[model samples]
Target: MSAKNAGSKPNKPADVIETGRLWQRPGFLIRRLNQIHISLFYESCKDFGITPVQYGVLTTLREHPNLDQTSLCAEVGVDRTTMADVLHRLEDRGLVKRKPSPTDGRIKIASITPRGLKVTEDMYEAMREAQIRFLSPLTPQDRATFVRMMLQLVEGNNQYGRTLLKHFD
Candidate 1:
C-alpha cells in the first residue's frame, strides 16, 4: 500500500510507520522543558544582580573556603578562563578576594568576602522559593524520585556530564 494509505489504516506494517515532525517528538518536549526551567532560574537570579553560574560559584566558595582556582573551577564545573572571568568580576565587585597561597606562590586561593556572604545569604530564601516553585508539580516523594533520576541521567556516565558542561564552559 502507499505510505499515505498505510498511515490512514490502523493495522499497518511497522516498517511503514513515518517519523513525526520535530515538534511532536518526545526529545523536543524534554529539551523545551529544560530551557524553560533554566530561563526561570536565570530570571529569578537577575533581581539579585547575578547569573545562575555566579550564584553557584559564590555558594560553592562559601561552603569551601580558601580553595585554589583550579579546585574552584572543578567544583563549579567552569573552565579556567570562565572561572577567571567570574572571579575577576566578583573581585571587582569586592565580593571575593584572590590571594597568593602563603606557602605556594604558584597557587592562588579564592575566598568569599563578608559582602559576598551577605549577598548570598540574602538570596538564600529566594533560591529556596524558586526551587519550590520549580518542583511544585511533584509531591515530596515524587520530587525526590525525580531528582534521583535526573542525577543518574546527568552523572551516570562521567563523559555525559562532562559533555554537557563543555557547552556551558
Candidate 2:
C-alpha cells in the first residue's frame, strides 16, 4: 500500500515491499536475491577465503577427477576465460593442479589436490549454514516450494544462457 493507504501507522515489511513493485520484476528480484545469498555466504564463510565460483570449481573437480578445462567450464556454467582465472587462482593457492590430459595430451586437465579436498570438505558446514540463513525467512514448505520453482525455471530456460550447464544424466 502507498503511504496514503497505510493509515499513518508504521509501514510494515509487507507494505514496503508492495510499494516497491519490485516483486513483479523477475530479473530484478533474481539479482537482488543473488546479492542477498552472496552476502550471507560471504558473512558465513569469509574465513574460508573462497568465493562460490571457486568452491564450485573445486567441488566439480572433486566429483569428476581430471576433467579437461573445456568440460569443467561447461559443467561449472562459466565462460572459458573466467574459468581460466578461477583455475589459475586455485592452482596458485595449491588447492588444485592443472596439467595436460593424458589421453589428449593437448587438452588441459584439472584435479583438486588433497589440500583442496580437505578445504572443500571443511567448508561444507559453513556453506550449509549460509544456505540455512539465506532461507531462514521462509517456512519449511515455502523453502521446498521455492527450490522446486527455481529448478523448474532453470531447467526450462537453460538454453538461453551463454554457458550450457551439464546434466547429471
Candidate 3:
C-alpha cells in the first residue's frame, strides 16, 4: 500500500490520527517562541552595547570564574569559533582576562574583570525591566513557574539541545 493511502481507513478512536500544518506542530511552536524571545532579548541588550550571547557569556563567567575556553563555549551554547571571537572582544574591552592555567599548559582560564562586573551591575536593572515586560502576560508566580518550565525543557531533555547543536556545528 502507498504511504498516503495506508492510513486512509479510520477505525477505532485509538487508531484514528489527525494531520495538521507545520505551524500547528509543537516543535515549530517552541522554535518560533525561542526565535521571538531571542530577538527581543538581543534588541533590548543592544542599548547596553552587548549582544545577548555576549551578555550570557559574561554572566556565565561571572558566576563561574576561571572557566576554560572549552567550558565557556559549552556553557554559553556557542561554537568554538564564535566563543573565541567573543573572548577576544571581551578581552580587548578589558572585561575579561584569559590566563594560562597554572596546572595545565594546554588550558586557558577565563575570568571576568572588575570592569565587566560593574557593567553587568549597571545593566542588571535594565535587563530585569526588559524581562518583566517580555513576560508581562504572566503574573509574578506564573513568571517564576514559566522560567522553571523553560529550564526544565532545555536542561531536562538531553537530546533536544544536542540535536540542535548539530545544526549549528
For this target, which candidate reaches the highest TM-score against the unseen true structure?
A: 2
Could you give candidate 1's per-residue lDDT for residues 26-81 as a string of tens digits?
45766997787777776666678877778888998998899888888777777788
- Worst 10 contiguous positions by lDDT, candidate 2: 10-19
For model 1, the stretches where C-alpha displacement exceeds 4 angstroms are 1-31, 161-169
- Model 3 is weakest, by summed lDDT over 10 consecutive residues, at 160-169
Q: How accurate is candidate 3 locally (lDDT)?
A: 0.76
- Using Cα atoms with residue i matched to residue i, what is each candidate's TM-score against the true structure? 0.74, 0.85, 0.74
The C-alpha stretches of model 3 lying farther than 4 A from their native spots are: 1-19, 160-169
Q: Give each model's clash number.
A: 0, 0, 0
Candidate 3, residue 72: how far the Cα is off, in Å: 1.7
lDDT of every predicted structure (CA atoms):
0.78, 0.88, 0.76
RMSD of 3: 7.0
Cα-based lDDT at residue 149, candidate 2: 89
- Top-scoring candidate (lDDT): 2
Candidate 1 residue-wise lDDT at 124:
85
Lowest lDDT 10-mer window, candidate 1? 160-169
What is the per-residue lDDT of model 3 for residues 1-169, given as tens digits with 9 covering 90 to 100?
Answer: 2366566785644233333556545577788977877777766666778767778789989888999887887777777888889999999989999999999988889999999999887878777776777788889999999888876666656354422222111
The TM-score of candidate 1 is 0.74
What's the residue-level lDDT of 60 in candidate 1? 88
